[model samples]
Target: MEIDKVKDPATVKLHSQVEMGSMELKSILGYDDQGLVAAPEKKSSDEAPLKVLYSSGSGSFNRKVMRNTVVHSIRTVVFSSRLNLLMPFGPLAILVQTLTGHHGWVFLLSLLGIIPLAERLGYATEQLACYTGPTVGGLLNATFGNATELIISIYALRNGMIRVVQQSLLGSILSNMLLVLGCAFFAGGLVFSKRPQVFNKPTAAVNSGLLLMAVMGLLLPALLHTTHTELHFGKSALALSRFTSCIMLVAYASYLFFQLKSQRSLYVPVDEGEEIHSDASDDDEEVPEISKWESIIWLTILTAWISILSEYLVNAIEGASVALNIPVAFISVILLPIVGNAAEHAGAVMFAMKDKLDITLGVAIGSSTQISMFGIPFCVMVGWIMGVPMDLNFQLFETATLFITVLVVAFMLQEGTSNYFKGIMLILCYIIVAASFFVHIDPTAIQDKPPETKE
Candidate 1:
């Protein structure tokens, strides 16, 4: 005789109820039918909340499954771009440093290696932003977008290469405002030759204002040093630099609050035509290629590799300058910024070509604002902690160049419209800046400065 095979009716009903409850719980926890988290969805106020309870084992199992999925996605994230081909340069740079004494080669390799990683870092950040809301995402972009320059500056500061740190930072701002923005304008003008490319004037105005403010902060310290108006000679310039940096940081934070919170509408694209185009483009919208956790992990890994490569690059700066017969100023001001910001430059130009000048401006002008108001000042504070004497006194020539660049950019942005001519002018101006730096000598270069000690 067979055992009773029929299930109790109450038992079958209870099992079905449990399964339904499990599905509801998964949905509430952001999982879809396959137990994978779906793309972020807007919650409706009218939808009833579902309540479900689960044992600890179920929670642990869910976490394990998620962890494994993220692990497998690593390959997708790493091989996502053709740029990974340059990743080998990272190992090559390290190998050159270990096996050879060619500082120039090491420096060149390191620079090439960091290019792809820098771009990938930005890619990862953008992917991660799919999960974080726009405000936080904007902040993340601001931070990581300049991570390369920041990391290099830190390494240079540690080695008492304060001038390198200052010049490189100045170069970043100049590159973004001039080279990147100019290229975007030029590309957009060519692509939309029949009509002028327009962007959010209010947003551009705000960024220009911040750039001018940064210029003022830098100018005063240089002026105090040059005009000998400091109350305490050498110490006064450093003191003012630190104080002004603190104020600038606060101002930047306030600006962030305004942009991301208070007056976000001012930054939104206003052209109805552009809005239609944007909506149409949504059909080709980019979906996140990797999970949020995967993005985070890749970012950490890329940043760490960049940091490692930066150390080698920083150590080779002077050596490379001598071996390559290039001025240290040129290397710092012209070469480094161009390479470090290659990703940003490409992104801005692409947006401009798409007639999305607002995004182009945000990429170019917004980056300049972040570097000037946030990155430079943050470096000053870090240097202060390490007693590196990293002040805002970027020297007379450098300060004048920065001031002129800001003025020129501010003028270009006044109309909130751009053409190839304006783009050409900006590019010519940057060329002048680069050529000037190539010939210019920093009287207070690392070799001339006295050794730094902790205060």
Candidate 2:
């Protein structure tokens, strides 16, 4: 329909910001067409009156386009604002972490520690959380993660700083064995009365077996070297130990290989409502992959910051006790790792809340692996660079605590089932370990031992 009004030379942009709806864009005319441009206001075609009162200029189609444009722009701005906060700090913190090794203590503060390690494990699992059909990727992501963490840890172990490596190893193990698994059992059991959901048989079986092996692997060296670790292994023993670790390593490799195969061949039907995390779901959106370059850059920076600040951390502790009046033991054992791990820990808990059991498990385990691998090795590498031989290793108690924790966790998660009872067991185990740290418990004195117990 054509209008009789003359064209107005002045057309000012007038934007209507609507609440709970898309904004509308209109052009205000100066003189010739001052009133609203009407497109033959028609009564409802079917006489429905209360819905849309009237239709105006160019019908509903033109208004929709304008409305859509405004809405998209508004949403873009809103989303970008949140991303803006992490844009600088997240990457920058990671970069600062990778470069300086102010000693292995950097592992705690440095976000780059795991980010780069995750990228380096590229031949294996990926960074992105897939959100699509089939559980192929999701299954692989979960099961194969152990291999990736092991690869990273091996690199860290070989680099040295036996203590730092050991400490980080202990840290990672405890976090997973106690914290992650415990949370899963606790949360899952608490939420529902039925037994916690289990994964496929083959995958669960392999995972349980590998976890048991890991427990054995960590314990072997400690037990063997308890007498004289300084007596570095001869060629034969070294070869044998390496060969053993290698065989254990091969088991993990087998697990990964089998997982990949299963990913292709197997098609176990998931719960109709079973949300395949990282495999497209109704609840959560997909995880954007971290870029390789960003991973590399941040890892370097994070290393540097951590290394540099460690001396400060050690130095500051002296004054911290004086100022804060906190005990040295509490500050050393609890506060430091907690502070350094704040980010990663949050990441783990977040995964749990999302019901990404695999990720929550992986992060806790990967962290220990990172601490053992990158954290320890980085410290050793830095020490070598500086020509300073640092005595960076954990105490016997720490290692024992970690070993015991993993042992118990392996037993609990062995059946691929978790519940409140299992969670309680984990928590109880953690408590026992903590108490052992403070009090003395000599098993040799009591000749009583439970089955599957850590000797």
Collision count for each candidate, in order: 0, 28
Local distance difference test, each candidate:
0.80, 0.43
Minimal lDDT window, size 10, model 2: 23-32
The predictions' CA RMSDs to the true structure, in order, are 10.0, 16.1
Residue-level lDDT of model 2, residues 243-346, one tens digit each, is 45546545655654664564634434334325534355643344433433433343344344434333344434434434444433433444444434433444
The parts of candidate 1 lying over 4 Å away from their true place are 1-77, 128-139, 271-273, 276-280, 446-455
> What TM-score does structure 2 among the candidates reach?
0.49
